[model samples]
Target: GKFPEISLDDYECVMAQVERQYNIRCYNLYRTYRTTKVRPIHVAPEDWQWLIDNLWSDEQFQKRSKQNSINKSKQEMKSLVGTINIETYEVTLVRNPETGAWPSAVDVWRAIYMKANGTWSIPNGAEILNNLEEAAETHKERIAAAPIPLAEHFALVLGRKPNHSRGVGIGAVNQGAQERYRIRARAEAADQRASDAQNQAAALLEEVERLT
Candidate 1:
C-alpha cells in the first residue's frame, strides 16, 4: 500500500516538536508511541511493529539511550528561554541590518539570561566570562572567522564537545544535511583544483608544441 512520503528533515522536525510539546526526551519517544498506541496514517502495521522490534528493543538503540543521558549530563550551559522555539525567539531579537542574520548563541543566551536574572552576570558567570576571555586571547583568528556563531558554532566558544545535535536544546534537525554539504563542498573544491591543474598542464603542452 502506498503511504504518504515525508522527507527525513521534516520527519525529524515533527519528532522534535512532538518531544518538546509532550516534554518527552527523544530516546523516550518510542516508548510514548508504544504506550499511546497511536500511529501515523502513513505507517503500516508491520512497519510499526518493525520499529518496536528492531529499534525499540535493539541493543544499539539502548546504547544510544545511555549515550544521550551522558550527553545531557555534560551540558554545562543552562537556558532560561523556556519552551519558546528558537525561530520564534529570533523574530523578537535584533538582527544585522545588512546580513539579516540572527545573533550568536552566546548573545542570545545573554539576552535571555538578562531578562530572567535582571543581568547577564550570574553567580558563577565570572568563570564562564574568564574562559571566554582566555579563549579570545588564545584563538584570535578562530573568533575572527565567526563574529556571530550560531547553532553548532557554540562548541568552539564554549570549549565543550558538541552533543548529537551540536547544540543545546531542540537544535535544527538538518545537522546531518549541513555536514553532508560541508563534505560535498570540500570534494567539489578538490575536483576543481584537479581540473585546474590538468588545464594548466594542457596549456603548457600547447606552448611547448608551438615553440618546438
Candidate 2:
C-alpha cells in the first residue's frame, strides 16, 4: 500500500509506536519473548527432549500396580508429547544478498524521505511496499515457530505412586511422598503470590511518582 506524504513528525510518530510495541532496553520483542524462565515445576514445555526424558519414571511406579502404572506413564508421555506445540508470535526477514539485510526498515525510511523531498515516485514506492510485504511473511513464519506455554505441566508428576516392595506393606511410604509434594506445591504457590504483590506495589509507586 502506498503511504501518504510522511512528515518528520510522522516519522517520530512511527518510532514511538514501535517503542510502545517493543521494549527498547532489552532489544528483544517485549510481547514475543518469554519474560520469565521460571516454571511451576521447573519444566520448560518447549524443551521437548527434557520433558520426554523426565516426565515419567518407570521405577517409581513398580509393584502390584506395576503394569497399570507403566501404562499410565506411557499415556502421560504421549499426552505430554502432543501438548507441546511451539508458538510463533513475530515476523522475520530473509536478508537480501545485495544489501545483507531485509529491506523493511530501509524501505520505510526511503518512502519517508521521498515523501519529504517531494520526489516520491509511484514505482519506487511500490517496490518499498513490496519489500515490506515479503519481510512480513518471514516474520509470520518465525512467530509460528514459538512454543506454547505449558500450564501446570508438573501437575501430572505429583501423587504418582510406586507399588509397595513387600506383598503386604503399609501404604505409608507413598502417602508420605504425596504429602510432601502437596506441601511444597502450596509453598511455591504462596511464594508466587508474594512476588506478584510486590510487583503490584512497585508499579503503584511508579505511578504515584509520575503523578507527583
Candidate 3:
C-alpha cells in the first residue's frame, strides 16, 4: 500500500477548511491545540508538529501575524449584520430598478436595530426611537454633504461607539482597548515583582542582623 502524494493546492484547500471550521489561523491554532492537548480534527498530530516546526515558528510570519491582529483591531466599524455580514446583506438588498441605487448601511442598520431593540435592556431604551429618528434626519443631511458608514452614523447621531462594551447594535470587540488593558496588566505584574523582591531583600537583611 502507498500513501497518495498531497499537492500544494490540496494542502491550501485543507488549511482553508481548517480555518473556516475552527475560526482560527496558524499561530493561534498551534498555541491553542498545543497547550490544551486537544487534537484538531483535520490535522494529524505529526502534521501539526511539522507545521509548528516549519511554518508557524518563522519570525517573519509571527511578526506579520501580530501586525495583522493589530490592524484588524483598529477597524472601528465592523461590517456585520447579525449572523450575516454587511456585504451579503448589500448583495441581497432590493435596488431601485430605475435609479440602480442600493440600500445604504443606515437602512440596513435600522432593520437590524428593530429586531435587536427589544432583546437587550438598552439604557434609556424608550428614548432610542426618538434618537434614531433624529439621527436619521441628521444622517440624511450629512450624507447629502458627505457619505459615512452606519457605525459612524450611530456614533455621530446616537452617540454610541461601535464596541460591545459601549452598547449593543452590530458592535465589535475594541481591540485597541483590549491591547491597552494587556499593557496595564503587564505593568501591574512588573510592579508586583518589584514589591516581592523588595520584601524578600528586607527579610534577608532582618535575618542577617538577627544572626549577627
C-alpha lDDT score of every prediction, in listed order: 0.56, 0.38, 0.53
CA RMSD of each candidate after superposition: 11.8, 26.0, 22.2
CA deviation > 4 Å runs, candidate 1: 1-31, 34-42, 72-76, 83-94, 98-106, 120-123, 130-139, 146-157, 162-212
Q: Residue by residue across 1-212, what tens digits does model 2's lDDT show?
A: 59766545445545654764564432232112234433334335665345335432234522423565454344231111132111110022233679654333334324333455555443445454455455446554542332210111111111223532121121223333333334445656889899999999999999999999
Q: Write one digit per residue (lDDT tens) for candidate 1, span 31-117.
A: 557578676666678977787777778889778877866765554344464433333454466547898555655566566545564
- Backbone clashes in model 3: 0
Where does candidate 1 clash, by residue pair?
Answer: none
Scanning candidate 2 in windows of ten residues, the lowest lDDT window is 148-157
Question: How do these models rank on TM-score, best leading?
Answer: 1, 3, 2
Reference-based lDDT, residue 50, model 3: 76
Candidate 3: 10-residue stretch with minimal lDDT: 164-173
TM-score of each: 0.45, 0.22, 0.36
Q: Compared to the true structure, candidate 2 yields what TM-score?
A: 0.22
Answer with 2 or 3, whichever has the higher TM-score: 3
lDDT of 3 by residue, 156-205 (tens): 54454446313323232344323333444565688989999999999999
